[model samples]
Target: MIATRDAYGEALAKLGEENDNIVVLDADLSGSTKTSLFAKKFPERFFNMGIAEANMIGTAAGLAAAGKIPFASTFAIFAVGRAWEQVRQSVAYPKANVKIVATHSGITVGEDGGSHQSVEDIAIMRAVPNMTVIVPADGIETALAVKAAADFKGPVYVRLGRNKVPTIFDDTYKFEIGKGVMLRPGTDITFIGTGLMTAQALVAADLLQAEGISARVIHIATIKPLDEEIILAAARETGAIVTAEEHSIIGGLGGAVSELLSEKCPTKLKRVGIKDRFGLSGKGDELLKYFGLLPENLVEAAKEILAEK
Candidate 1:
Protein backbone atom coordinates (compact mmCIF):
# COMPACT_ATOMS: atom_id res chain seq x y z
CA MET A 1 0.00 0.00 0.00
CA ILE A 2 2.87 2.39 -0.77
CA ALA A 3 1.34 4.44 -3.53
CA THR A 4 2.88 7.88 -3.30
CA ARG A 5 0.63 9.16 -6.08
CA ASP A 6 -2.32 8.64 -3.78
CA ALA A 7 -0.57 10.54 -1.01
CA TYR A 8 0.21 13.42 -3.39
CA GLY A 9 -3.45 13.85 -4.33
CA GLU A 10 -4.55 13.59 -0.71
CA ALA A 11 -1.89 16.03 0.43
CA LEU A 12 -2.83 18.56 -2.23
CA ALA A 13 -6.44 18.47 -1.08
CA LYS A 14 -5.43 18.80 2.56
CA LEU A 15 -2.96 21.57 1.81
CA GLY A 16 -5.61 23.41 -0.20
CA GLU A 17 -7.93 23.47 2.81
CA GLU A 18 -5.25 24.96 5.04
CA ASN A 19 -3.95 27.49 2.50
CA ASP A 20 -6.48 29.70 0.79
CA ASN A 21 -3.86 30.85 -1.69
CA ILE A 22 -3.48 27.31 -3.03
CA VAL A 23 -5.17 26.42 -6.35
CA VAL A 24 -5.18 23.23 -8.48
CA LEU A 25 -5.38 22.69 -12.25
CA ASP A 26 -5.37 19.40 -14.16
CA ALA A 27 -5.05 18.58 -17.88
CA ASP A 28 -8.21 16.51 -18.13
CA LEU A 29 -6.46 13.65 -16.29
CA SER A 30 -7.92 14.18 -12.85
CA GLY A 31 -8.77 10.49 -12.55
CA SER A 32 -5.49 8.95 -13.73
CA THR A 33 -3.31 11.65 -12.26
CA LYS A 34 -5.31 11.28 -8.99
CA THR A 35 -6.24 15.00 -8.80
CA SER A 36 -9.92 14.14 -9.03
CA LEU A 37 -10.06 13.74 -5.27
CA PHE A 38 -8.97 17.35 -4.88
CA ALA A 39 -11.49 18.45 -7.51
CA LYS A 40 -14.31 16.72 -5.67
CA LYS A 41 -13.54 18.50 -2.41
CA PHE A 42 -12.49 21.96 -3.65
CA PRO A 43 -14.51 22.37 -6.80
CA GLU A 44 -14.13 26.13 -6.89
CA ARG A 45 -10.37 26.03 -6.53
CA PHE A 46 -9.74 23.13 -8.95
CA PHE A 47 -9.73 23.71 -12.71
CA ASN A 48 -9.80 21.06 -15.43
CA MET A 49 -8.06 22.27 -18.61
CA GLY A 50 -9.47 19.57 -20.88
CA ILE A 51 -6.37 17.57 -21.91
CA ALA A 52 -4.45 20.73 -22.74
CA GLU A 53 -1.28 20.63 -20.65
CA ALA A 54 0.19 23.74 -22.21
CA ASN A 55 -2.90 25.76 -21.47
CA MET A 56 -2.96 24.47 -17.95
CA ILE A 57 0.61 25.58 -17.41
CA GLY A 58 -0.11 29.06 -18.73
CA THR A 59 -3.14 29.24 -16.51
CA ALA A 60 -1.01 28.31 -13.52
CA ALA A 61 1.43 31.05 -14.36
CA GLY A 62 -1.40 33.59 -14.44
CA LEU A 63 -2.65 32.37 -11.08
CA ALA A 64 0.83 32.72 -9.61
CA ALA A 65 1.11 36.21 -11.05
CA ALA A 66 -2.08 37.11 -9.25
CA GLY A 67 -0.66 36.11 -5.84
CA LYS A 68 -2.11 32.61 -5.83
CA ILE A 69 -0.19 29.34 -5.45
CA PRO A 70 -1.23 27.10 -8.35
CA PHE A 71 -0.49 23.39 -8.66
CA ALA A 72 -0.73 21.81 -12.10
CA SER A 73 -1.26 18.07 -12.53
CA THR A 74 -0.71 15.76 -15.49
CA PHE A 75 1.16 12.66 -16.62
CA ALA A 76 4.95 12.95 -16.55
CA ILE A 77 5.20 12.70 -20.32
CA PHE A 78 2.82 15.58 -20.89
CA ALA A 79 4.34 17.74 -18.19
CA VAL A 80 7.85 17.37 -19.61
CA GLY A 81 7.07 17.06 -23.29
CA ARG A 82 3.81 18.72 -24.24
CA ALA A 83 4.02 21.47 -21.66
CA TRP A 84 7.79 21.90 -21.57
CA GLU A 85 7.96 25.27 -23.30
CA GLN A 86 5.17 26.65 -21.17
CA VAL A 87 6.83 25.38 -18.03
CA ARG A 88 10.12 26.89 -19.05
CA GLN A 89 8.76 30.26 -20.12
CA SER A 90 5.94 30.81 -17.67
CA VAL A 91 7.10 29.04 -14.51
CA ALA A 92 10.88 28.59 -14.52
CA TYR A 93 11.96 31.79 -16.21
CA PRO A 94 9.95 34.06 -13.95
CA LYS A 95 10.20 31.66 -11.00
CA ALA A 96 6.50 31.49 -10.36
CA ASN A 97 4.88 29.73 -7.44
CA VAL A 98 3.71 26.83 -9.57
CA LYS A 99 3.90 23.25 -8.37
CA ILE A 100 3.98 20.64 -11.11
CA VAL A 101 2.64 17.36 -9.74
CA ALA A 102 3.32 14.68 -12.35
CA THR A 103 2.06 11.17 -11.73
CA HIS A 104 2.83 7.75 -13.33
CA SER A 105 6.37 8.77 -14.04
CA GLY A 106 8.93 6.37 -15.56
CA ILE A 107 7.86 3.06 -17.10
CA THR A 108 5.39 2.50 -14.30
CA VAL A 109 2.66 3.83 -16.56
CA GLY A 110 3.01 0.24 -17.81
CA GLU A 111 0.65 -0.86 -20.56
CA ASP A 112 0.39 2.72 -21.78
CA GLY A 113 3.96 2.16 -23.03
CA GLY A 114 6.45 4.74 -24.31
CA SER A 115 3.90 7.35 -25.28
CA HIS A 116 2.67 7.70 -21.73
CA GLN A 117 5.98 6.81 -20.04
CA SER A 118 8.29 9.66 -19.04
CA VAL A 119 11.96 8.70 -18.70
CA GLU A 120 13.46 12.09 -19.54
CA ASP A 121 11.14 14.35 -17.61
CA ILE A 122 13.50 14.98 -14.72
CA ALA A 123 16.42 15.78 -16.96
CA ILE A 124 14.42 18.26 -18.99
CA MET A 125 12.82 19.82 -15.95
CA ARG A 126 16.09 20.03 -14.05
CA ALA A 127 17.86 21.72 -16.94
CA VAL A 128 15.38 24.59 -16.77
CA PRO A 129 16.57 27.51 -14.69
CA ASN A 130 14.87 27.89 -11.26
CA MET A 131 13.04 24.59 -11.37
CA THR A 132 13.24 22.36 -8.29
CA VAL A 133 12.81 18.70 -9.18
CA ILE A 134 11.81 16.11 -6.55
CA VAL A 135 11.29 12.34 -6.84
CA PRO A 136 9.75 11.20 -3.57
CA ALA A 137 10.44 7.56 -2.52
CA ASP A 138 7.00 6.82 -1.03
CA GLY A 139 3.71 8.23 0.19
CA ILE A 140 5.16 10.14 3.11
CA GLU A 141 7.80 11.90 1.09
CA THR A 142 5.25 12.72 -1.56
CA ALA A 143 2.99 14.29 1.05
CA LEU A 144 5.93 16.20 2.51
CA ALA A 145 7.12 17.45 -0.88
CA VAL A 146 3.63 18.58 -1.86
CA LYS A 147 3.30 20.48 1.40
CA ALA A 148 6.77 22.03 1.09
CA ALA A 149 6.29 23.16 -2.51
CA ALA A 150 3.40 25.40 -1.52
CA ASP A 151 5.68 27.37 0.79
CA PHE A 152 8.53 27.70 -1.71
CA LYS A 153 7.97 30.67 -4.05
CA GLY A 154 9.20 29.05 -7.25
CA PRO A 155 8.43 26.37 -9.78
CA VAL A 156 8.71 22.86 -8.26
CA TYR A 157 8.41 19.58 -10.14
CA VAL A 158 7.48 16.59 -7.96
CA ARG A 159 7.55 13.12 -9.51
CA LEU A 160 5.63 10.13 -8.09
CA GLY A 161 4.91 6.61 -9.30
CA ARG A 162 1.64 4.66 -9.61
CA ASN A 163 2.61 1.21 -8.32
CA LYS A 164 1.83 -0.02 -4.77
CA VAL A 165 5.00 -1.03 -2.98
CA PRO A 166 6.07 -1.45 0.67
CA THR A 167 6.26 1.47 3.09
CA ILE A 168 10.01 1.72 3.76
CA PHE A 169 9.78 4.58 6.25
CA ASP A 170 8.47 4.31 9.83
CA ASP A 171 6.34 7.46 9.43
CA THR A 172 9.29 9.39 10.86
CA TYR A 173 11.67 9.84 7.94
CA LYS A 174 12.44 13.54 7.64
CA PHE A 175 12.25 14.28 3.90
CA GLU A 176 14.03 17.57 3.39
CA ILE A 177 14.19 19.00 -0.11
CA GLY A 178 17.69 18.95 -1.68
CA LYS A 179 18.89 16.49 1.00
CA GLY A 180 19.63 12.86 0.28
CA VAL A 181 18.65 10.21 2.88
CA MET A 182 21.17 7.51 3.80
CA LEU A 183 19.22 4.38 4.67
CA ARG A 184 22.06 1.85 5.07
CA PRO A 185 25.70 1.99 6.12
CA GLY A 186 28.28 0.42 3.90
CA THR A 187 31.95 0.80 2.96
CA ASP A 188 32.40 -1.29 -0.18
CA ILE A 189 30.01 0.61 -2.42
CA THR A 190 27.30 3.27 -2.48
CA PHE A 191 24.01 2.38 -4.13
CA ILE A 192 22.30 5.63 -5.24
CA GLY A 193 18.77 5.52 -6.59
CA THR A 194 15.79 7.86 -7.02
CA GLY A 195 12.03 7.37 -7.26
CA LEU A 196 11.03 3.69 -7.65
CA MET A 197 14.63 2.52 -7.98
CA THR A 198 15.39 3.62 -4.41
CA ALA A 199 13.22 0.80 -3.13
CA GLN A 200 15.06 -1.61 -5.39
CA ALA A 201 18.41 -0.40 -4.06
CA LEU A 202 17.23 -1.00 -0.47
CA VAL A 203 16.21 -4.56 -1.27
CA ALA A 204 19.49 -5.11 -3.09
CA ALA A 205 21.46 -3.91 -0.09
CA ASP A 206 19.68 -6.49 2.07
CA LEU A 207 20.56 -9.27 -0.38
CA LEU A 208 24.16 -8.08 -0.44
CA GLN A 209 24.32 -8.41 3.34
CA ALA A 210 24.06 -12.24 3.17
CA GLU A 211 27.12 -12.30 0.91
CA GLY A 212 29.09 -10.10 3.36
CA ILE A 213 28.91 -7.13 1.00
CA SER A 214 28.47 -3.78 2.67
CA ALA A 215 26.68 -1.42 0.29
CA ARG A 216 25.18 1.90 1.34
CA VAL A 217 21.74 2.82 0.01
CA ILE A 218 21.27 6.55 -0.57
CA HIS A 219 17.80 7.76 -1.55
CA ILE A 220 18.18 10.77 -3.86
CA ALA A 221 14.70 12.22 -3.80
CA THR A 222 15.77 15.67 -4.94
CA ILE A 223 17.24 15.60 -8.43
CA LYS A 224 17.78 19.20 -9.58
CA PRO A 225 19.83 20.90 -6.88
CA LEU A 226 21.59 17.62 -6.04
CA ASP A 227 22.99 17.01 -2.55
CA GLU A 228 26.61 17.04 -3.59
CA GLU A 229 28.12 16.87 -0.13
CA ILE A 230 26.29 13.69 0.79
CA ILE A 231 27.15 12.13 -2.56
CA LEU A 232 30.79 13.12 -2.29
CA ALA A 233 31.03 11.73 1.24
CA ALA A 234 29.54 8.41 0.14
CA ALA A 235 31.89 8.28 -2.82
CA ARG A 236 34.89 9.10 -0.64
CA GLU A 237 34.01 6.36 1.84
CA THR A 238 32.95 3.60 -0.57
CA GLY A 239 35.28 4.37 -3.51
CA ALA A 240 32.71 2.83 -5.85
CA ILE A 241 29.19 3.84 -6.82
CA VAL A 242 26.26 2.16 -8.57
CA THR A 243 23.27 4.24 -9.77
CA ALA A 244 19.83 2.77 -10.37
CA GLU A 245 17.07 4.75 -12.06
CA GLU A 246 13.82 4.08 -13.91
CA HIS A 247 14.85 6.67 -16.51
CA SER A 248 17.16 6.45 -19.49
CA ILE A 249 20.91 6.21 -18.88
CA ILE A 250 21.33 9.59 -20.59
CA GLY A 251 20.15 12.43 -18.33
CA GLY A 252 18.25 11.51 -15.20
CA LEU A 253 19.69 10.69 -11.79
CA GLY A 254 22.48 8.73 -13.44
CA GLY A 255 23.55 11.74 -15.47
CA ALA A 256 23.27 14.05 -12.47
CA VAL A 257 25.52 11.80 -10.37
CA SER A 258 28.00 11.18 -13.15
CA GLU A 259 28.29 14.91 -13.85
CA LEU A 260 29.08 15.66 -10.21
CA LEU A 261 31.38 12.68 -9.60
CA SER A 262 33.38 13.23 -12.78
CA GLU A 263 34.28 16.78 -11.84
CA LYS A 264 34.31 16.54 -8.05
CA CYS A 265 35.49 13.08 -6.93
CA PRO A 266 36.20 10.96 -10.05
CA THR A 267 34.85 7.82 -8.41
CA LYS A 268 34.21 4.49 -10.13
CA LEU A 269 30.53 4.36 -11.09
CA LYS A 270 28.05 2.09 -12.88
CA ARG A 271 24.66 3.22 -14.24
CA VAL A 272 21.66 0.89 -14.72
CA GLY A 273 18.59 2.04 -16.72
CA ILE A 274 16.93 2.06 -20.13
CA LYS A 275 19.42 2.22 -23.02
CA ASP A 276 17.69 4.72 -25.34
CA ARG A 277 14.71 2.49 -26.03
CA PHE A 278 10.98 3.10 -26.01
CA GLY A 279 8.60 1.04 -23.92
CA LEU A 280 5.55 -0.78 -25.28
CA SER A 281 2.26 -2.04 -23.90
CA GLY A 282 2.82 -4.13 -20.73
CA LYS A 283 2.14 -4.21 -17.02
CA GLY A 284 4.25 -1.99 -14.75
CA ASP A 285 6.30 -4.78 -13.19
CA GLU A 286 6.85 -6.39 -16.55
CA LEU A 287 8.49 -3.21 -17.90
CA LEU A 288 10.63 -2.92 -14.77
CA LYS A 289 11.75 -6.54 -15.08
CA TYR A 290 12.43 -6.01 -18.78
CA PHE A 291 14.38 -2.80 -18.14
CA GLY A 292 16.72 -4.56 -15.66
CA LEU A 293 15.33 -2.79 -12.58
CA LEU A 294 14.59 -5.98 -10.65
CA PRO A 295 16.25 -6.86 -7.35
CA GLU A 296 18.32 -9.55 -9.08
CA ASN A 297 19.55 -7.01 -11.60
CA LEU A 298 20.58 -4.61 -8.86
CA VAL A 299 22.43 -7.37 -7.00
CA GLU A 300 24.26 -8.32 -10.20
CA ALA A 301 25.20 -4.68 -10.78
CA ALA A 302 26.56 -4.38 -7.26
CA LYS A 303 28.62 -7.54 -7.74
CA GLU A 304 30.05 -6.15 -10.96
CA ILE A 305 30.94 -2.83 -9.33
CA LEU A 306 32.60 -4.65 -6.44
CA ALA A 307 34.59 -6.78 -8.88
CA GLU A 308 36.04 -3.67 -10.46
CA LYS A 309 36.96 -2.29 -7.08
Candidate 2:
Protein backbone atom coordinates (compact mmCIF):
# COMPACT_ATOMS: atom_id res chain seq x y z
CA MET A 1 0.00 0.00 0.00
CA ILE A 2 1.31 3.45 -0.88
CA ALA A 3 0.96 5.69 2.15
CA THR A 4 2.72 8.99 2.98
CA ARG A 5 0.66 9.72 6.09
CA ASP A 6 2.52 7.19 8.22
CA ALA A 7 5.79 8.31 6.71
CA TYR A 8 5.13 11.90 7.83
CA GLY A 9 3.99 10.67 11.24
CA GLU A 10 7.11 8.63 11.79
CA ALA A 11 9.32 11.43 10.52
CA LEU A 12 7.79 13.96 12.91
CA ALA A 13 8.07 11.49 15.77
CA LYS A 14 11.78 11.08 15.05
CA LEU A 15 12.28 14.82 14.75
CA GLY A 16 10.59 15.43 18.08
CA GLU A 17 12.71 12.79 19.81
CA GLU A 18 16.04 13.86 18.33
CA ASN A 19 15.68 17.67 18.24
CA ASP A 20 14.67 19.52 21.36
CA ASN A 21 13.98 22.57 19.24
CA ILE A 22 11.29 20.80 17.22
CA VAL A 23 7.68 21.63 18.13
CA VAL A 24 4.42 20.39 16.52
CA LEU A 25 1.08 22.17 16.36
CA ASP A 26 -2.15 20.84 14.84
CA ALA A 27 -5.61 22.34 14.26
CA ASP A 28 -7.18 19.65 16.46
CA LEU A 29 -6.44 17.24 13.63
CA SER A 30 -3.73 15.22 15.32
CA GLY A 31 -5.28 11.92 14.31
CA SER A 32 -6.12 12.87 10.75
CA THR A 33 -2.92 14.81 10.12
CA LYS A 34 -0.88 11.93 11.64
CA THR A 35 0.64 14.39 14.12
CA SER A 36 -0.58 12.20 16.96
CA LEU A 37 2.82 10.54 16.90
CA PHE A 38 4.53 13.76 17.86
CA ALA A 39 1.84 14.54 20.43
CA LYS A 40 2.20 11.13 21.98
CA LYS A 41 5.98 11.17 22.06
CA PHE A 42 6.46 14.76 23.17
CA PRO A 43 3.25 15.84 24.84
CA GLU A 44 4.73 19.00 26.27
CA ARG A 45 5.95 20.30 22.94
CA PHE A 46 2.80 19.45 21.00
CA PHE A 47 0.00 22.00 20.75
CA ASN A 48 -3.55 21.10 19.79
CA MET A 49 -4.87 24.42 18.53
CA GLY A 50 -8.47 23.19 18.14
CA ILE A 51 -9.29 24.01 14.52
CA ALA A 52 -7.96 27.55 14.58
CA GLU A 53 -5.66 27.49 11.56
CA ALA A 54 -4.81 31.21 11.70
CA ASN A 55 -3.99 30.97 15.37
CA MET A 56 -1.95 27.86 14.68
CA ILE A 57 0.15 29.75 12.14
CA GLY A 58 0.52 32.71 14.47
CA THR A 59 1.53 30.42 17.34
CA ALA A 60 3.99 28.60 15.11
CA ALA A 61 5.48 31.94 14.12
CA GLY A 62 5.84 32.80 17.78
CA LEU A 63 7.46 29.47 18.52
CA ALA A 64 9.95 30.01 15.70
CA ALA A 65 10.90 33.43 17.00
CA ALA A 66 11.68 31.79 20.34
CA GLY A 67 14.29 29.51 18.70
CA LYS A 68 11.95 26.55 18.27
CA ILE A 69 11.54 24.74 14.95
CA PRO A 70 7.75 24.66 14.73
CA PHE A 71 5.80 22.45 12.33
CA ALA A 72 2.16 23.51 12.07
CA SER A 73 -0.35 20.98 10.77
CA THR A 74 -3.72 21.52 9.04
CA PHE A 75 -5.52 20.67 5.83
CA ALA A 76 -3.81 22.30 2.82
CA ILE A 77 -6.65 24.78 2.27
CA PHE A 78 -6.47 26.06 5.83
CA ALA A 79 -2.70 26.28 5.83
CA VAL A 80 -2.50 28.34 2.64
CA GLY A 81 -5.85 30.13 2.51
CA ARG A 82 -7.06 30.49 6.08
CA ALA A 83 -3.67 31.34 7.50
CA TRP A 84 -2.26 33.10 4.45
CA GLU A 85 -1.83 36.53 6.05
CA GLN A 86 0.06 35.20 9.05
CA VAL A 87 2.24 33.05 6.85
CA ARG A 88 3.03 36.08 4.69
CA GLN A 89 3.54 38.72 7.38
CA SER A 90 4.86 36.76 10.36
CA VAL A 91 6.72 33.84 8.78
CA ALA A 92 7.75 34.68 5.22
CA TYR A 93 8.44 38.36 5.84
CA PRO A 94 10.61 37.70 8.90
CA LYS A 95 11.94 34.44 7.45
CA ALA A 96 10.97 32.44 10.47
CA ASN A 97 11.73 28.75 10.93
CA VAL A 98 8.09 27.67 10.67
CA LYS A 99 7.17 24.58 8.66
CA ILE A 100 3.61 24.33 7.37
CA VAL A 101 2.93 20.61 7.03
CA ALA A 102 -0.27 20.32 5.01
CA THR A 103 -1.72 16.86 4.61
CA HIS A 104 -4.85 15.90 2.60
CA SER A 105 -3.81 18.23 -0.15
CA GLY A 106 -5.28 18.45 -3.65
CA ILE A 107 -8.19 16.38 -4.95
CA THR A 108 -6.53 13.44 -3.23
CA VAL A 109 -8.60 14.39 -0.23
CA GLY A 110 -11.28 12.26 -1.98
CA GLU A 111 -14.70 12.42 -0.34
CA ASP A 112 -14.03 15.86 1.11
CA GLY A 113 -14.74 17.23 -2.38
CA GLY A 114 -14.30 20.83 -3.55
CA SER A 115 -14.40 22.31 -0.08
CA HIS A 116 -11.29 20.56 1.24
CA GLN A 117 -9.38 20.38 -2.05
CA SER A 118 -6.26 22.59 -2.17
CA VAL A 119 -5.96 23.10 -5.91
CA GLU A 120 -4.71 26.71 -5.67
CA ASP A 121 -2.43 26.27 -2.69
CA ILE A 122 0.69 26.04 -4.82
CA ALA A 123 -0.06 29.20 -6.78
CA ILE A 124 -0.80 30.98 -3.52
CA MET A 125 2.18 29.69 -1.55
CA ARG A 126 4.63 30.01 -4.41
CA ALA A 127 3.93 33.72 -4.54
CA VAL A 128 5.43 34.20 -1.07
CA PRO A 129 9.00 35.53 -1.28
CA ASN A 130 10.73 33.46 1.41
CA MET A 131 8.44 30.44 1.19
CA THR A 132 9.80 27.08 0.08
CA VAL A 133 7.11 24.86 -1.46
CA ILE A 134 7.59 21.08 -1.56
CA VAL A 135 5.33 18.30 -2.82
CA PRO A 136 6.94 14.89 -2.28
CA ALA A 137 6.01 12.04 -4.67
CA ASP A 138 5.49 9.39 -2.00
CA GLY A 139 5.92 8.29 1.59
CA ILE A 140 9.71 7.98 1.63
CA GLU A 141 10.31 11.40 0.14
CA THR A 142 7.76 12.93 2.48
CA ALA A 143 9.81 11.61 5.38
CA LEU A 144 12.97 13.02 3.87
CA ALA A 145 11.33 16.39 3.12
CA VAL A 146 10.23 16.61 6.73
CA LYS A 147 13.80 16.21 7.89
CA ALA A 148 15.02 18.59 5.22
CA ALA A 149 12.48 21.21 6.21
CA ALA A 150 13.88 21.10 9.72
CA ASP A 151 17.24 22.11 8.29
CA PHE A 152 15.76 25.03 6.32
CA LYS A 153 15.89 28.43 8.01
CA GLY A 154 12.77 30.08 6.60
CA PRO A 155 9.08 29.28 6.01
CA VAL A 156 8.23 25.99 4.22
CA TYR A 157 5.03 24.48 2.86
CA VAL A 158 5.36 20.71 2.55
CA ARG A 159 2.32 19.55 0.58
CA LEU A 160 1.54 15.84 1.09
CA GLY A 161 -1.08 13.52 -0.38
CA ARG A 162 -3.68 11.99 1.91
CA ASN A 163 -3.47 8.39 0.68
CA LYS A 164 -0.72 5.78 0.43
CA VAL A 165 1.41 5.92 -2.71
CA PRO A 166 4.02 3.60 -4.13
CA THR A 167 7.58 3.87 -2.84
CA ILE A 168 9.26 4.42 -6.22
CA PHE A 169 12.71 5.46 -4.94
CA ASP A 170 14.91 3.62 -2.47
CA ASP A 171 17.03 5.01 0.35
CA THR A 172 19.98 5.37 -1.99
CA TYR A 173 18.37 8.45 -3.53
CA LYS A 174 19.26 11.77 -1.92
CA PHE A 175 16.84 14.70 -1.56
CA GLU A 176 17.55 18.43 -1.28
CA ILE A 177 15.26 21.47 -1.36
CA GLY A 178 15.14 23.39 -4.70
CA LYS A 179 16.34 20.26 -6.54
CA GLY A 180 14.27 18.04 -8.84
CA VAL A 181 14.91 14.34 -9.44
CA MET A 182 15.17 13.11 -13.03
CA LEU A 183 13.84 9.58 -13.20
CA ARG A 184 13.57 8.26 -16.79
CA PRO A 185 15.57 10.06 -19.48
CA GLY A 186 14.18 10.43 -22.96
CA THR A 187 14.89 12.51 -26.04
CA ASP A 188 11.38 12.35 -27.43
CA ILE A 189 9.26 13.95 -24.74
CA THR A 190 9.44 14.89 -21.06
CA PHE A 191 6.85 14.02 -18.41
CA ILE A 192 7.14 16.25 -15.34
CA GLY A 193 5.00 15.78 -12.25
CA THR A 194 4.88 16.31 -8.52
CA GLY A 195 3.09 14.49 -5.66
CA LEU A 196 0.66 11.79 -6.85
CA MET A 197 1.06 12.79 -10.48
CA THR A 198 4.71 11.66 -10.39
CA ALA A 199 3.58 8.12 -9.68
CA GLN A 200 1.13 8.33 -12.55
CA ALA A 201 3.88 9.72 -14.78
CA LEU A 202 6.04 6.67 -13.98
CA VAL A 203 3.21 4.38 -14.99
CA ALA A 204 2.64 6.44 -18.16
CA ALA A 205 6.34 6.13 -18.99
CA ASP A 206 6.11 2.36 -18.75
CA LEU A 207 3.10 2.31 -21.06
CA LEU A 208 4.74 4.72 -23.50
CA GLN A 209 7.90 2.58 -23.48
CA ALA A 210 5.90 -0.38 -24.74
CA GLU A 211 4.60 1.75 -27.62
CA GLY A 212 8.16 2.65 -28.82
CA ILE A 213 7.88 6.12 -27.32
CA SER A 214 10.67 7.37 -25.07
CA ALA A 215 9.41 9.52 -22.20
CA ARG A 216 11.56 11.18 -19.56
CA VAL A 217 9.87 11.52 -16.19
CA ILE A 218 11.08 14.05 -13.63
CA HIS A 219 9.78 14.58 -10.12
CA ILE A 220 9.44 18.23 -9.20
CA ALA A 221 9.49 17.72 -5.46
CA THR A 222 10.26 21.33 -4.82
CA ILE A 223 7.62 23.47 -6.51
CA LYS A 224 8.64 27.06 -5.77
CA PRO A 225 12.19 28.16 -6.55
CA LEU A 226 12.04 25.32 -9.03
CA ASP A 227 15.17 23.71 -10.42
CA GLU A 228 15.32 25.68 -13.64
CA GLU A 229 18.48 23.97 -14.83
CA ILE A 230 16.83 20.54 -14.82
CA ILE A 231 13.63 21.89 -16.42
CA LEU A 232 15.49 23.81 -19.12
CA ALA A 233 17.62 20.75 -19.78
CA ALA A 234 14.52 18.64 -20.31
CA ALA A 235 13.18 21.18 -22.76
CA ARG A 236 16.51 21.23 -24.60
CA GLU A 237 16.78 17.42 -24.61
CA THR A 238 13.13 16.78 -25.50
CA GLY A 239 11.30 19.12 -27.82
CA ALA A 240 7.90 18.63 -26.14
CA ILE A 241 6.81 18.44 -22.48
CA VAL A 242 3.78 16.99 -20.69
CA THR A 243 3.12 18.11 -17.13
CA ALA A 244 0.71 16.21 -14.86
CA GLU A 245 -0.48 17.16 -11.44
CA GLU A 246 -3.29 16.67 -8.86
CA HIS A 247 -3.90 20.39 -8.97
CA SER A 248 -5.38 23.02 -11.24
CA ILE A 249 -3.50 23.39 -14.52
CA ILE A 250 -3.54 27.17 -14.22
CA GLY A 251 -0.90 27.81 -11.55
CA GLY A 252 0.52 24.55 -10.26
CA LEU A 253 3.37 22.44 -11.67
CA GLY A 254 2.27 22.92 -15.26
CA GLY A 255 2.12 26.70 -14.98
CA ALA A 256 5.46 26.84 -13.21
CA VAL A 257 7.19 24.70 -15.85
CA SER A 258 5.58 26.63 -18.67
CA GLU A 259 6.71 29.94 -17.17
CA LEU A 260 10.33 28.72 -16.95
CA LEU A 261 10.43 26.96 -20.31
CA SER A 262 8.84 29.99 -22.00
CA GLU A 263 11.72 32.26 -21.04
CA LYS A 264 14.25 29.56 -21.93
CA CYS A 265 13.56 26.89 -24.57
CA PRO A 266 9.91 27.58 -25.56
CA THR A 267 8.91 23.96 -26.12
CA LYS A 268 5.54 22.40 -26.91
CA LEU A 269 3.73 21.58 -23.66
CA LYS A 270 0.37 20.14 -22.51
CA ARG A 271 -0.91 20.04 -18.94
CA VAL A 272 -3.15 17.28 -17.49
CA GLY A 273 -4.91 18.20 -14.29
CA ILE A 274 -8.13 19.68 -12.88
CA LYS A 275 -9.34 21.80 -15.81
CA ASP A 276 -10.40 24.91 -13.97
CA ARG A 277 -13.05 23.12 -11.92
CA PHE A 278 -13.49 21.92 -8.35
CA GLY A 279 -13.68 18.21 -7.54
CA LEU A 280 -16.61 16.10 -6.37
CA SER A 281 -17.01 13.63 -3.49
CA GLY A 282 -15.75 10.19 -4.40
CA LYS A 283 -12.85 7.75 -4.03
CA GLY A 284 -9.46 9.32 -4.70
CA ASP A 285 -8.74 7.25 -7.78
CA GLU A 286 -12.18 8.00 -9.18
CA LEU A 287 -11.62 11.73 -8.86
CA LEU A 288 -8.17 11.41 -10.39
CA LYS A 289 -9.55 9.45 -13.31
CA TYR A 290 -12.36 11.94 -13.73
CA PHE A 291 -9.90 14.82 -13.87
CA GLY A 292 -7.76 13.11 -16.53
CA LEU A 293 -4.71 12.76 -14.30
CA LEU A 294 -4.36 8.99 -14.49
CA PRO A 295 -1.67 6.98 -16.28
CA GLU A 296 -4.03 6.46 -19.18
CA ASN A 297 -4.61 10.19 -19.35
CA LEU A 298 -0.90 10.96 -19.37
CA VAL A 299 -0.35 8.31 -22.03
CA GLU A 300 -2.93 9.95 -24.29
CA ALA A 301 -1.47 13.41 -23.62
CA ALA A 302 2.03 12.09 -24.26
CA LYS A 303 1.05 10.44 -27.53
CA GLU A 304 -0.76 13.55 -28.71
CA ILE A 305 2.11 15.81 -27.66
CA LEU A 306 4.81 13.66 -29.31
CA ALA A 307 2.81 13.47 -32.55
CA GLU A 308 3.85 17.07 -33.21
CA LYS A 309 7.43 15.91 -33.74
The CA lDDT at 259 in model 1 is 99
Give the poorly placed runs of model 2, Cα more than 4 Å off: none
The CA lDDT at 176 in model 2 is 96
Per-model TM against the reference: 0.98, 0.98
What is the C-alpha lDDT profile of model 2 across 1-309, one tens digit per residue?
556777898999998878999999999888988999999999999999997999999999999999999999988989999999999999999999999999999887999889999898988898889999999988889889999999988899999878888888888879999999999888789999999889899999999999888899999999988999999999998888999888889988999999998888899999988899887889998888888889999999988887776
Tell how far residue 234 is off in model 2, in angstroms: 0.8
Error at 47, model 1, angstroms: 0.5
Q: Top model by lDDT, which number? A: 2
> Cα RMSD (Å) per model?
0.9, 0.9
Q: How do the residues 36-122 of candidate 1 rate in per-residue lDDT, one tens digit apiece?
A: 888999899999999899999999999999999999999889988999999999989998989999998889889877888888888
Score residue 173 of candidate 2 by CA lDDT.
Answer: 79
The lDDT values for all models are 0.89, 0.91
